[model samples]
Target: MGTPLLVAEDISISFGGIRALKGVDLTVEEGQIVCLAGENGCGKSTLVKIVSGVYTPSTGTISIGGDSFNALKPRQAIAEGVQVIYQDLSLFDHLSVAENIAINRLIHDGSVLSNRAEVQRIAAEQLERIGIDLDLDAPVSELSVANKQIVAICRALSMDARILFMDEPTTALTTNEVKRLLAIVLDLKKRGMAVVFISHKLDEVFEIADKITIFRDGSKVGDFTASELDEVSLSFHMTGREIVYNRYHRTRTEDQPLLEVRELSRADNYEDISFTVRPGDILGLTGLLGAGRTEIALSLFGLNRPDSGTILIDGKTAAITNPWDALDYGIALLPEDRKTQGLFGQQSVKTNITSTMLDRLLTPMRMISGRKEDALATELVHSMNVNNKDISVLVDNLSGGNQQKVVLGKWIGTEPRILILDSPTVGIDIGSKSEIYAKIHDLAADGIGIIFISDEPEEIVANCNRVLVMHEGSMITSLEEEDLRADGIKERLAEIISDPDSFAGTNSGARVQGEQA
Candidate 1:
């Protein structure tokens, strides 16, 4: 390979007493895919954060094209042609594709201040280069996650970035979309652009990578050519310890659905959404981003009002006018966006956990005692396996997985009859994911109806008794028992999206039943 576009040596990062990255070494050859594989807390994100200038390494050297860049700041890193596409893709959805792509140029207001047409032309060219032919004026929010990711790639390419870092690029992409994105990555590699691909999916890594590095507990396990690794070995390296990747083949309870939504319509977002979540049963919802998975959860949790529908709780029609109303009806929700919607970042871990149960903690004086609060909080923190030195610690300081645990812990403490978790394992480690799944299983076993909404299909198929597929604001179809495979669900969802009326009774058709978008 030609001179490496970027190389980092002995990168070490520490957070207080915890060493997030220890002696981690990596290299990105020009026009090549370099994959960093590890469990969530194994320093993959931390390493990428260092490369992207979001975090400074405690000890390390980062060189761009053989030039040392130890002190490079984020803007400086981008200026030097380094781009990090985060898990969310970092695109502001409200803006048009053209505006999102041309952001940097707009920020600089360069000497060509009067050349607005030229800027648009350049953005259009970048889009074309990335094989995206969408309307430049189209709203990014309207774009599918796969298309949005391509738009992000176009924006980075617009910067003329020398090296691009993709973090879990396909976490939300369908198989076809994933293939298309990979083709684009390969095309970029052919065009001599370096790529650092970080993913939880090993098959994608093996398919795309030239070199692979595994990190465990902030330390590098080993680095080798793609030819030197396989799924078994790569996974073995990721977790560092033996793990049994077992899923409950069938965890359904014969109990009928305790919660039912009928003819739920939410205007333009989702339409005629209907599904049943059974008590002592785990009902999983899966779809692409903007596929109405989260939308359905939010609507059921009273975060959004359905234009018209009947939400039946325990076979009884109920009005969930607000979240408090949902809570009053024994419904609890763990929102998708944790920092904003899930947790109060500034509060203590204890306080965050107990906020959902004030009435239980109150005295006859209607006041909560700090001691009772601490006791309850301590029990929950331990139960959820939230990692924190002290219950008094601010929740903001904990890792993403711990924060997520706290979010679930908050709702779990409420003892709701119905629990809805939206992407509950988004940022959690494999260990934590197992823990959370166990908790979900335990809850389901206890007769608490659970709605598990996730972008990961395997997860839905594995943990849930029934898989509900939503698209364009409605629960289009559902898969049970033998038909809940990821590919099967996507096909079914697409068919329904094309014509909900047409695919009403078809059992996951392979035939194209509706108009393509």
Candidate 2:
């Protein structure tokens, strides 16, 4: 409808034998939000990478402002004013806000020494212009997730990028932060910036996107106006088939609990919380951002300590003081933040696959033998169906699905009894999700108890046999086979959070901040 801001026609890219993107066509119009949606390994990231110049499409022609462009090199793409903010916030926590924001400009200016003062001024001005009240000199780690996110956006602005690609931009953002970010996006659009938002949250895609692009298996399926798409219809396109969007398929057994987390109190995260993840269970934990779903996983993984609590892994009390201990206790955590605790981007598949099991495989010298590591990695790669050229390839080079498979592989190699998948399917493709689902079934069939956490209520209902709903920092209620519906769970959680007196039954001291109304 409007003049295109950026366009790519017949884009193609290959990795070894795999055609990651095949003649895909996409565009972003000026002052518009066009979102691309699909399952992991569906070429969404590939397209974004090509547009942002992180990858040069093996073949394709691109134009920005109706002029030809190629992102053969990263600097070339940056100079061309195409910016990308990946799933991981690219801010350096040790750096000041100014340093992070003005990095591109300062480095581009070719200053022999860093221009700290000028960078600070420019960063502060950018924040001020965006109406965000952040201190320029503050260390990034000191800022909240929302503020740190703003800093990432400011850094993008410094590139003067006409088109910005945001991958899962609001994955961890609270509803309010999401609103603020959307407002900022709209403000940038009014100023004639083109934004390409990629996310799994369909509610967000429907709300902010003016146009939507659908990608399936390395090709663009079709494009549609936002008004022309709804969640069910769009899910069909993204998944390439009919998928019943049901969130309550829990089937709890009337037996003793498989896992009884009694008084699980992690200081400042959750307190005095008791819950059970039963066998053949998909314990659905839903809450707004910072509702402590992730913190709970971390404590279970032994990454963090609960001030006081009892974890009965299998009717037996267990002391899990660290990740190794958790693994030994048959508890494996697929961390919420994939980059932080999930993947080793720079490491080879072999290295990362056995990283979690080094203590188990290594001799007293603690050096993991290459043969043992290779054997474990090879087994996991095959078991998880990791599609890649070789086992030694860097995990980052693979598609999202394959990368996720590697993440799965790492955990499976450890072979814990309780497998904790925190948003394991986030930002991945349908086929990959199905594969992951099969893997989940396989793990369950093998009698591994699972605690699966996701924002998508539908995913929890369909894949899990039992759902546990959380609000603030407490597990409000558990959903059995009969009570696994999203609407039912949602209403229950809402009622619990809405009525303060109802919480008298629950004395959870840990608070959940920033939940959407």
Candidate 3:
């Protein structure tokens, strides 16, 4: 490795008697990509914030180019050529792309008057340096998620940053967008800039990381080169447990489907979709970002009404015009974005958990029954294995895993016959993921028909008894039983995602039936 550009030694920090970080050491060399990986609440963010001058470690020393400091302020870190791009990207939605790129430089240089032409010129130069092209005059709000991320990167580079940290950059990006972002990161590395990538996705870590450091429960577990570890070992290091894939097998009780969708069509989102989920079966829907998987889920949950289709529940036609109708029809949905779509962040855990079942918790006087609500919330929280013991605490105070559990608890409390989980374990940790998978299996065994949607092949293979693959707003293929167990599922999925046109010829039938063993 070349000379070390950023070194953080023996970092320790605590808050309100709780240790957030403990004796963590991190180093980034010139022209190298280091990945910092850990489960949620594992101190990865704290350590990075310490290095980037957002947090002052209780005990540590950070050195940049042989210069040491006990702590740094925001301006000081920027002056030292350090930049951080958070998950939110932190761009002004109302401003133009050019203004967003050049605002940092203008603020740093104490510019008195705004110059539109100079801002566009600065943005053009930065974009040219990064080998990307975009309309500078376009408002940031109109840009896609991937383009917003690009603007964030250009904004950092405009400040002449030598060390860059990207936190969970690919969480919301499409497959192609992720690849483009990684290519840009590699180009920066080749230019002698140090890059620190923080993400929960192992495939990405292996693809772009030169070295990796793992954190667990506020301590550094170990560090290794990319070749030294695989996904399983890396998961173990992150969560201190082995993640075994135990596929759930369903025992068919009756031929009658619990929920059936026939000829479901939503203009640009999906077309000619048909599927059936039996009681105690976990049906997985997977596809690329814009493949209409989510739109189908939204239709099922009544968030998006289908243009033309028939939904049958218990062999009877159903009309679902809104979420309330869906709920009345014994259906529940756990959305993909928990923070925005699922939880009532400022409310108490008990309130969030019991939000869906408030009608049942009403008293004879028409007022809510507080005692009954508490008991029901308590039982659901325990059933879902929520980490927070006190149900009275606000949901926002919990970790990512617990917040997700709260969402599940809320929906499961509704006692729906059909439950649709959209990317349930997106930001959760390994241990929590295993727990959630087990919970899903248990739910199915209790005769709840589950519709599971995800983009990860391993998750589908592990927990689902049947799989449906979608591409370009249509169902490409369906795998069941042994077909789902085939080792080539990932390869097939890759082909479908990377080259949709090549797979279209094989889609002679709308849904290919899989053999049952």
Candidate 4:
């Protein structure tokens, strides 16, 4: 390995009596791709922020090249060739791609004039440097998630970044987009740039990381080469425990389905989709991005009303015009994007957990009873294994996994008989995922049907008794029982996605009524 490009020693930081990080050390060599793996709130972000000069560590030192500093400002970090692409990307949505890429450099150079041509020229050169092609004149808002990420990388290159840090970079991308981003990271490493990749996806980390650093509860667990770790071992290190997952088995109380959708269709989103979720069944919905998986869940939860469809709850046609209507019918949706669609981040965990069931906690006077609210929140949090000891803590203060738990708690507290979980475990650590899988199985055992939507085939294969595959906003096929192995599902999904025409004639014996390709 080459000389260390960046070295951090004894890094520690505290916020209002909470030690967010403690005595963490990290070293990244030139051309190294070091992946920081940990559960949310485990000091990964804290250490990265300290290293990138967004936060000055209460104690410790950072060394870049041959120089060491007790603390560095953001500008000083930039001057030392450090750049961070945060999860949000931090790009101006209204600006053109060229402007977003070149605006930083123009400001750093103190160029006051708004020069569109100059911006395009600089943006093109940066894109060329990275060997990525993107339209310079396209508005940033119009770019795909993948292209926006490429633009972000080009923007970092424009600043002459020697070491780059990408935080959860692929959380919002499609499978192909993730592959492309990993290739770009590899290309960057080949070009001798030290990269710190922070992510919860163990598959991506195993694919690209040269070195892996594990963190748990504000401290380093250990650091090892990627060859030294597998997914289970890596998960153990992050969570300080072994997580064993068992395949799901159906345990329904009745022969009839708890919820059924017939000929569901919505303009520009989904078409001719039909499915059924029996009591105690964990129905997996697998699809690529924009396959209308989320849209279907939304319609089921009454967030989006289908133009032509019938929703049957307990074999009776139900009219679900809004979330309230859905809840009244004992249906709940844990949306894909928890940060926006699920949790009120600024509110307390108790508030978020009880937000969905305010009516049930009302007193004789019809006023919200604080005691009843606290009791319900505490019960749900305890039952859901939420990691917070203090229920009054703001939801924003919790880690991503805990925040997700709070969201689940909120829905489960509503006493929903049918739950629609859209990417329920997205962006959470592996340990948390195992816990969630266990909880889902437990929920199934209690006769609450679940519609589990995710892009990951492994999750579907492991957790669902039945799986539905969607393509081009339609249910193309379904797999059940013996047909739900990972390899088989992956092969079938690949065939359908790669050549939809090949399966147009072959039914595969898994067709449902109103299913369209």
Q: What are the Cα lDDT values of the candidates?
A: 0.79, 0.76, 0.88, 0.87
After TM-score superposition, the amount by which residue 350's alpha carbon in candidate 4 deviates from its true location, in angstroms, is: 1.2
What is the C-alpha local distance difference test score of candidate 1?
A: 0.79
Q: How good is model 4 by TM-score?
A: 0.95
Query: Clashing residue pairs, candidate 1?
Result: 270-473, 271-473
Q: Report RMSD (Å) for each prediction in the order shown.
A: 4.5, 4.9, 2.2, 3.0
Q: After superposition, how far is residue 248 of candidate 3 from its true place, in Å?
A: 2.8
Residues 1-517, candidate 3: write the lDDT tens digits.
5899999999999988999999889999999999998888999988888887899999989999888999999898999999999988999999999999999999999998879888999999999999999999999999988999999999999999999999989877767788899999999999999999998788999999999999999999988999999988998899888987578989758658999999999999999898999999999988787889899999988889999989999989999889999998899999989999999899999999999998989998988999999999999989989987799999998888889999998998888999999999887777788888998899999889999998777787788988888887888777777776666765665555556665664552444332222
Give one digit per residue, the lDDT tens place, for model 2 in 1-517: 8888788989999988889999988878888988989877788888877876778887879887877865446777777788888877888989988888998778887877776788888898788877888888899989887788899899988778788888888866655677899999889889888899988778888888888999887878899988998877888898878655333233434456667888887766876677777666666565555567888888888887888889886789988889878867878888775665688899898887778777767867887777777777788888889877388998887777788888888888777777888888876655677678878877776666788887664466567766555666766555555544334554454444344245444433323211231
lDDT (10s digit) by residue, model 4, range 107-143:
8888989788889899999999878888788899999
Clashes of each: 2, 11, 0, 0
Query: What lDDT does model 3 reach?
Result: 0.88
TM-score of each: 0.85, 0.81, 0.95, 0.95
Ten-residue region with minimum lDDT total, candidate 2: 508-517
Which candidate comes out best when scored by lDDT?
3
Provide the lowest-lDDT 10-residue window in model 1: 508-517
lDDT per residue for candidate 1 within 406-470, as digits (tens), equals: 99999989889999998888756566677788888888888888888885655766688777766
Which residue segments of model 2 deviate by more than 4 Å?
15-19, 53-59, 70-76, 109-121, 243-254, 323-328, 343-383, 388-393, 409-416, 441-447, 455-458, 461-483, 486-517
Arranged by lDDT, best first: 3, 4, 1, 2
Model 3: residue 80 alpha-carbon error in angstroms: 1.1
